[model samples]
Target: MLTLYRPGDGPWHRLPAGPKSLVLLVIVLGVSLLPATWWCAAVAVGACVGCYAVRGAGMRDLLRQVVTVRWILLVTLAGQLVFTGPETAVANTARVGAAVVISGLLTLTTPVSELLDVLERAMRPLAWLRIDPQRAALTVAVTLSTLPVLARLEREVREAQRARGGGRSLRLFAIPFLVVALKHADALGDALTARGVR
Candidate 1:
């Protein structure tokens, strides 16, 4: 579910990131902004999983993925259920959340390189505007890659602080990530400049 290092030799794993990203964007936007309906939502989820199955994804691995992402979706769905009529709210929550889950499924199925390629192809139209699309795509891809690393760093930092008798607070969680991000951003910028990529 965390999708740490689920490497495989499947066709999806070989897909370029750019096309996969395009598919993710289209599906997420379509499913999220469309009408709220339980049946529709169920179909969307099934379609996502179907893609995995077609690509030879196993049940246990997919279940782990669902478990990893379900925590937030479940909480949101719970709140939605409490605030609105059960029938309407439940349907709407499922529709919206299924979109999110589908997007995650795309990410899990597609490799990051494929995502980059997708982005590059997408940004081709903007070439007339003197935009470096690959650079832009790389920026996004790099940010995505950094998310888990930063999360892990934040967890380690918090645990170290707690071990030293530090109290829990949002600030403790926020500060370490922000500081680390800033430092890394600077280093990345410097590297890009050195390579004439900036």
Candidate 2:
């Protein structure tokens, strides 16, 4: 299922998923509201590093999370630099990067089952609005599981393109990537149907 949970006996790992998720939400919101300043960016990134250290996660694990979103961060920085200035660009990129790291830490410590349980329980209040908590939780689970799959598909497509001397052509990359993604979606739908999801 492409679970990212890293088994550990640290305090963060022992923390309940509900509280951990709430803390993550608060951190993300706080980061979003902070001004685009170098100090703010440094503080945000520093907080994430502190959290990782407290959680006993290695620098390598944090680096892996950063690497996963390197391209996105670079593009964001570039666009901001052109539209705004270097200061705002770096601050915004750090803000986004910190948020991603916080999220990765949550998933690293909490099991998928625990997260789904928390999500389901949290959605119970919405049942009066005809919202099915189970279905909603299942949807979230599927979405989370699909992200790694899509990432893998993207890497494979890029590698194949390069092998055929396609260089960095977006068109060549997008075409095969989309096709494979659609195929994965169709298969996932079939599996869900077989399991009586609907």
Candidate 3:
């Protein structure tokens, strides 16, 4: 999956990070709320396309990037088709698939720093709840950063497994990844503490 952040200086980069985070939730909810009809999906797609364009994204680039998560999108679409009536299957699947792509566009347009800034801002109210806002923001940052780290490790491990013909064994793959993730998680916690984010 593509990350939501990149170094940039566009208008999106200048916008308050707090508002952008809410947008992620809005995109998913708005997409899911539409009726399972061809016209609705078409409208959703058009709306999403407009949002992307407003954020300076090209249609081809958007489509090309969504290829990373196509499998998940396909599975979702397939599930909707099998359960929903055949008459509405195509429309439903299209809507679901388009929604995923459209929502993903927000990530592509927004930088991850903006995300952490949003996280920090959003968690401010936690102080009233006796929660440490810095700790909360650090937690969110760790969570966000892990996806990329794990993806890197998985790619490396999968390559090594394929070399040794261990790729076919689910047990071999899962165990190593879990072990590495645990070790990394501990180190991350230590780093956060050292930085006084806790």
Point to the candidate with the largest lDDT: 2
TM-score of each: 0.67, 0.90, 0.70
Rank the candidate models, highest lDDT first.
Answer: 2, 3, 1
Go through the candidates in order and give the C-alpha RMSD of each one to the true structure.
4.0, 2.1, 3.7
Residue by residue across 102-130, what tens digits does model 2's lDDT show? 77777778888998899899999989999
Ranking by TM-score: 2, 3, 1
Q: Tell me how candidate 2 scores on lDDT.
A: 0.84
Please state the error at residue 91 of candidate 2 in Å: 0.8
2 against 3, candidate with superior lDDT: 2
Q: Report how far residue 168 has shifted in candidate 3, in Å.
A: 3.6
lDDT of 1 by residue, 142-194 (tens): 76666556556666777877887777877766777678778877887898789
